[model samples]
Target: MPEPIELHHQGVERSIGCYLLDTDDGPALFDCGPSTTIAALKVGLAAEGLRLVDIRHLLLSHIHLDHAGAAGALVREHPALQVHVSEIGAPHLVDPSRLERSARRLYGDSFDTLWGELTPVPEANVHVVGDVVVGLACFPTPGHATHHVSYLDDDGTLYAGDAAGVRIQPGRYVMPPTPPPDFDLEAWQRTIDEMDRRAPERLALIHFGVADDPQRHLADLRLELFDWAEFVQGGASEEEFIAYGRAELADAGEDVAVYDVAMPLWQSYRGLARWAETR
Candidate 1:
């Protein structure tokens, strides 16, 4: 097992990351960056003496554009590539028209520019697995998205997509990426507890790098989720939520670049607010 290489996109250090893992079967990539970042991914792979077509397995945390947007294009290019994703998210990846429409409601005109065109992945290339991948274990870690999954490598490293929220570093705050429709607080809490039970020694966060302190990271994220949920339940408007989020990020010394992407504070407020109303 080779050490995971982080592919920083668009010259941004910590905005979005695509991780490459070398396995016995072949070179595998976890979470292809959004379609817009495909060129950067190509560059990253070339530096490693590999190419996009060289990737045999693509492990997606979910079908969210930021995480798996490039998957379709990659699959189309790499004939032998197999996509390992949650069963719930598989259908959407096969035909992303519905997902694209939903995202348009949120992102408006910038949708295509930010995420690029999402192509349909062939069904034959899809591999729906449960809590495991290539000898590693995968946990159905929902809450961030109904279709989200987290992979735990044999070395006790948890590839926590959005399951652990956005923690750029140990000193930074763990901000929840709660989006509309499927941000289940109950399930997310349960997922957090499950992660705690597993007690991974290190966490490989998709937002950026890895963290050796899993316990502290999970504890902080759990608390942050509760705090944000309660705050949103108080009926704060989107503007207020953004203001609050900006302040919090500044206080914690996190890069405000996170706000520039799809998982902004407004989406978090909306997701938590919806969860509060229904649950």
Candidate 2:
């Protein structure tokens, strides 16, 4: 049997999407969480019977801190590490100024606390994924972040960042992470179509664990997004819309997840303001 891929989730809330994927060449890490959560991730990794230095590769789904926040610090810690990210996002990884500026607006002073200091991923070590069959692949899944890209493992599993939307559980509902500036509805749908085209048997969402039913979950996600779009396109005030979204959450009534778009998740909209703007 192929060596089972080990997947562990850490720093979900702090925007740190930490995962360890076991491969034949050795073990690989998906995204390392923020600096603070690095310890937590290390602990989690150890629990799986591994350590930080054991990780041979670090693959990122996108450039957003929550997803790739600790990449620089990680590279700092393990000097020989190789980092892979989307071409669109690779430059920002090497020079996080633009990434930092945008995040500062959304996070203010707490950006450091939530994501740790984003250091630059050395350009020499960065690869702008241009070919697939060569191994790991980057699938453009914009709208969440114009620079966003997700990873596809040869096993037919997708490490989909915000491209597939956010859900608290596998067999659960989805809500857009709609945080500000670059959420394009048009791009998002096309990305989803592309995702379905790949026919991934499993999905690893940054917010939570692996999902087995991609089609069902995607269907649910589309409905919720439309619900939000209709609320916006139909002329509902922000207050009414937020309240309405909450009410809709109440209606879903499964393993519940309700984020106050008005209240935010971290410091800015907490993730709500951007979501509202996207809507």
TM-scores, all candidates, are: 0.94, 0.83
Per residue, candidate 1 scores C-alpha lDDT tens digits across 156-221 of 888888898887654457788998979988899999999999988888777766878889888888
Q: What does candidate 2's lDDT look like per residue over 1-66, in tens digits?
A: 112122222322322345677655577877665555667777777887887788888877777776
In terms of lDDT, the poorest run of 10 residues in model 2 is: 1-10
Alpha carbon lDDT at 263, candidate 1: 58
Cα-based lDDT at residue 169, candidate 1: 55
Best by lDDT: 1
- The TM-score obtained by model 2 is 0.83
